[model samples]
Target: MELQKTMQRSLRSEIQKRLKENGYTLSKLSELSGIGTGHLSEMLNSSPSRAITVNQLDAMATAFGHAPGWLYELYPEECLSEGKISRPRLVPYLVRCAEIGRKDCIKAVVSNLLENPKNISILFSVAEQLFQSGKQKESVFFYELVIDNEKDSYSDQFVMSQYRLFRAVQGTNTEENWKAVIRFDSYWKRLPENVQLDALLQLANVCFMMYRWKDVEKYADELRNLATIVYENELLRRTSPKANDLLKTERHLVVYYGQGFLLKAAALKKQRLYEEAKQYIQGYADLGWFEILDETGQQEVEKFRVWAKINSYTLDMMLGNYEILPECITFLEDHPGEIFPALVTIMECANKYGFCIDEVLERFSEYTSYTEDDLNGLSASRHFRFRYQKAIYELQRERFNIGINETLRSLALADKMNHYQDFKQCVSLFEEHRHHASNSQIIAYNKIIEGGTQTNESSVTLVSSSFGIL
Candidate 1:
């Protein structure tokens, strides 16, 4: 980045030194070099960056007994006297400096080149290198330069610029991400088969983040189609000497289709299409969905597989397949994302069956303890459910006042979140547990329920669950 002007010889000084050494007058030198005397004088008198045109440079270097490209090659960086830098020489240094983790060098190059609008290609290349090295945020400025200034729509750089822009915004769950996908999908369909498949998998993620379930299925089907073609061609390439090429890998298909399966399974479950949902899980298991994640995707495939399995168990539970409960508990314990529904289900089933309610409560506590920190996507219903687990824990342990207080807390949170499902569940827990609850607990619960649950907590009442079900 630091170039010493004092130690470096100026092109004007070099030309004068060569002229004196050769004992050639300006007119004689210009005549021999075939450059006009006026232009030759300007070349020697002007600064290095603007010394001469390429043809005149070649002519002068050759007449001075140096190689044709020798003069320009001698001075590659900025010419401070002329305030002009060489694009060809400066561009590579910027890229290499970034590669070796030299931020100061890149800053220096960018400061000089950013003044010239045409250095956008260098900007884009350096951006791509930064992106590959996991510096996506840092690479954003370079992508913006090409995207904002370059007008060519059909070029690869334009397509990549849009794709990278989509990558940058998709995780924030912003409206800009939706717009990015629209821009990305417009040209994504026309890309090469391999390139299109890569974008297709990412598009599925974008749709998933937006909760566009049907679009997830559509992209999944598209990915399956593209992957099948790649696999079929891979079969063709097997006859060649380079049969073991990494390009033949179709594991991405499994990743995309696995996600698609999960999304479809979830949608079908919502529609009460249990048989169809079960079918999706069967397909997923048939492929050994866990192993298919080896090629990797943006989402954690193993975690996703656990989620899908938990979902399958839910569908089983809804279908009266109570036998799947223990396995479901194991998976819910294993992977804790999307935990609200599972917590509610496990707690209700545990209470109904008189299972190890304390162990279940502990599991609930382990998973739901994260709410105090306000994690991303921590919904109000989930928070309500966490408090519900706390209430049930207290009730099961005979701490009636604390249990009732927890239910009241859940009621307050549910009301604030407008979570009717949690409100109803809280009411039901009150109905089933008021026998052991105290006067203040009963009054508080009744006030929160506000006629949704009317109970006489003054008398001895027995509320029994089937302890033999387990």
Candidate 2:
């Protein structure tokens, strides 16, 4: 009954009547709501009345023994003044609406606001505020709305919305991640420099995961050049003959500088440019001398130092320098996090150079097992790579049963991870060695193929075309 009354009346009228019915004076209501008496009177009785904020409305709701957002359906009135959206009132109200799961109210308010196309900026601002406040999932509604309504593709807000959306949707699925990259690719150069730095870094990382080595090198080089220019400019800015306002980036400046080199080196290694990759590795190997080392920056420098060490050894191992094998194993034993990737490299080297690593494989049999929790961060991709490489290694050694089993296991993970490229490679590898497969291995292969067929049938575009099908 009370909800119906609230539905029928404006928020101000509803609050006014509630105070009267409860026998609460202006002073009493103000005391209950923590609103100033003068402001309360202006809100309830003035000729043109002041707009109420969402917080004040929520306070009044609490004062009147009602739930939070009890008056939300009527609260949209406070977000307008003579039919112009009251930004000061609307912004918080929209954010609060999202917080309280008032999607209908959000939709009503947003639909009215968007009648004027210029209000896309207003929506974008609200989205940015929400994103900054750690309301990422909620911000997607506004970002998507901005993307849908935005007319200028190159506009900062549009590009920013695209970038934010891109970041939000990234996940373990490689095909979906690639689609996101493709959607956001053109907007990379158009983003504000701070956003561009993070975007380029993300682009390079995603490309690395997809085995897009050239693209990784391209974006990583761009990230390096941009970070250097920005870092140098920041230095000049700080030493200027005026105020000392610092430049802002999503991460510490050194991270971009270091990772730019790190990712580029990683890509170079993937592409078999070992010596060239080593030079880039040397680029970020020592960042203790970088300017402006805060605690976080210092920590990043330490990380890069560690990465430089691991990757330097990684390069030597990749070059088939078998002398350092035991040393690398000890290093990996010391840093368990590096084990899966190191194993991938080890298996690859073993396959390429025709070396026996049966003992080495047994040494880390725990990680060699495909448990999700065991390989937490680099879980899906690295495991997939390791299994693929192990399959190749075993097959080259004529160990058909173990090789085909590894191939089937990798195919299952690739399908689940939506890693289409690896999935195809696994399929091709399995077919090439099908004649040696035992009956049960053949049955397991058939089941995996059937599951993949169902997945491809259900979401053909996502499963196939997004990764270019071939």
Candidate 3:
């Protein structure tokens, strides 16, 4: 009887506490849960509370988001002293089960927690576990629950931020990624303007990734404005060297200006405005920004130069301006070790006008050499361009067999190249010859041509053939 009385009192106290947290008076809770107000008042007022039915306890628990079992087990000491059975403890055990990737265990745990709703921390912990295991969508739902229930909590915002950032890192769609930016932006805006600048910068980075230059420009402009405001403030300017330095970093200005120019150039190029694109590129070049690049940035600038020159050559060739050929060749010769872009330009020039094949072949042979290791140290695309030029030159000189031999040599060289596209082309060419010659014979001949063997049998046959060796 004492055990029963203690359990009743504990249940009444637990119910009242939950009702208070939910902003409900006993009268209001009774109305909400469809329990009689008189019975609730009596339960709360009794020295040892009257026994409530299981169904009544469940109704009150549902209304107030409290676990009925948690309330029932609160008087465990009393139950043990009186030799009465107590309800079980399961929340911690279920949490452990979820940790080991047991889906059934996780489902059972989630179901049990949902029955009580007050175990919000357990729900959040489960969501975090799911998220860490790559269950993004499920994690998102539970995170939403935590946010809705705990709006004033800083930890809730942080968790949502982490989830959104993870999705962004995993390369979510542009719209969704931008939505996250907007969400973070809105939150940051509520802070001081100075505090908001970093968030704006992050949004700009996302815009840059999505190639939304206009949005990048917009956010960059805002950051610049904020920086200026901070800069003009005597107090902030005097005390905040870090902020001042951030404002002055070249990345802030360069990304804003350089990306704007690039986007404009791309738009002009797409519209066949070759002259306009050249004007913009030349404008950027004249600013000396390209010259100011550090080692890695300088390499990037060189790559851009090659890309720009190739496009320019294509345009000039389309216009039948043969004079452009000399300029293109000069550019290629100037960049000796950087053979890919140079070879591309030479081939384009050769294809445009019927240039002297033997002369080009002689020039290419004089200009290039293979190392003992056969590692040309050139990019795969460039190396393949060199091989293609060589093969075409030999073919044009009526040296089909030598061209075939050189093609086979190129296949061997291609094996050591990095670029898959170039490797695929070489493999395809090699495969074409397999139908006419034994694979082993071809491999052996290729080895000789690659300087792996001293045998001149193939060279002798080429010299004797009607297709004369060059």
Candidate 4:
């Protein structure tokens, strides 16, 4: 196969031409670019010129009154050393190209680098370096390259790249989030144990939001078991003292352990298994007794303690224990972040047991009016659920105007989120009470449905445009 050709003029040649044209000596260029004259001389004039670093190249460009990547088209020549890909030159160049939005250069360099299959590892490392430096969006280009070119599915680079791609691809769009989760599901177990714990927890959370209760339970169980194993290994490590090579997780060990129980219980609660969920909730309730509680671990324990109380009250409410209602409200008032989900529970129960929450609804009226920013925050899923439940609660109370409006808002949000279950519920609830809706409400509902259709079409166009990039 023919190696993809690079620019005819070398990076050194371009720099030399630029210097002569501007009548700037090497010493003057070095002073302006913050590079030493001796080093710049070696880079520009050696028999086999020393490779120019990305920072130095950018510096030269700036000193020459050009943009950061002005000489990038000529850089592919620098990435080669006697017809072979040179890692030292290629890696930093590709990263800088991504930083400067030079996809044309990235495509050209990556195509050439892939001709020899062994060069795949260099791309994987480039992806990792970019990711670790918080250039997540830019790193996706190399990660996708790794995924497409990697032939060994079980290789560590292949698995790690898949995991990174999964994490990097998630955004506010629920449909996209779901697709990412599904694509990443099978690979979670193949990741290093530390990452696997975090991945499982994330999977459960996403599934929970999408109302995929069974999948949530599945991931939660895996999380619980793995967290236990990791915790025990940590215990043995503490005792053994063999240089203290700890398995570093993204969060505290206690967090993964607690969340394992917390998620399992939450999923069960969603499935209406109140009694079964209570057992799992108790598992995380008193993690204060857990060994090796660092400050963060202690804080996670307190969080679980709070979650235990919240979930206990939620189960009682679901079981029609309305007598505990006042205390539950008091507890929620103390934890503002928990208020939205608590409200969702309150509304769901009211609709279930034929109770009136007119007072409860009035008390938390401020939270009902969600803003656009809420869609990107921690409570996005809860906010969506709250809208749906509030619509049901209002419709049941015979408040036609408010109910229809809330229904329309929930329907639009669900469609935007690609939350099919909630979307269907909104449609069914509206239809069931269609007789009560005004002419304007009916028209509004029709438009929301029409808008959803258009959004899906636009999404298709976007995915088509994005195909080769991934």
Per residue, candidate 4 scores C-alpha lDDT tens digits across 1-470 of 23433434667878898999999998899899999999998998887777778888999999999998888888777777677777887888888888879999888877778998899998998899888887877788899999999999999999999988877765445678788887898888889999999888778776766778999889889999999999898888888847475678888888888888888888888788989999998898899888978788798788788878987887898998977889998998998766766778888888888888889888988876776545541355666677788888888788888988888888887777777777888899899998999998889899888874324322221110000000
Instruction: Give every collision pair in model 4.
Output: none
Candidate RMSDs in Å, in order, are 16.5, 6.1, 20.6, 5.7
**Over the stretch 177-222, how does candidate 2's per-residue lDDT look in tens digits?**
7898999998889988877898998887777778899999899899
For each candidate in the order shown, give its overall lDDT on alpha carbons: 0.60, 0.80, 0.50, 0.79
Q: Judging by TM-score against the true structure, name the best candidate.
A: 4
**Which 10 consecutive positions of candidate 3 have the poorest summed lDDT?**
461-470
TM for candidate 1 is 0.53
Candidate 3, TM-score vs. the true structure? 0.34
lDDT of candidate 1 vs native?
0.60
Better-scoring candidate (TM-score), 1 or 2: 2
Task: Write out the backbone clash pairs for model 3.
Answer: 340-382
Q: Can you tell me which runs of candidate 1 are displaced by over 4 Å?
A: 1-118, 242-244, 248-253, 270-272, 288-308, 320-323, 331-359, 371-470
Error of 1 at 240 (Å): 3.1
Top-scoring candidate (lDDT): 2
What's the distance in Å from true for residue 308, model 3? Answer: 4.4
lDDT of 1 by residue, 1-470 (tens): 24665457655677788899999998989888998887876667654324455455557888988864444534334322266555454544444444445566565556666676666677887778777766665666678777877778777787788777666544322244467678778878666666676677667655544456677677767776776666567557767886774462223545544555655565455456779878876555445533323445434444455655666677677676667877777766655654555766556555545555566565566565543224222233345655787688778877887787888878766654334566678778778877877887777766766744322212111111000000
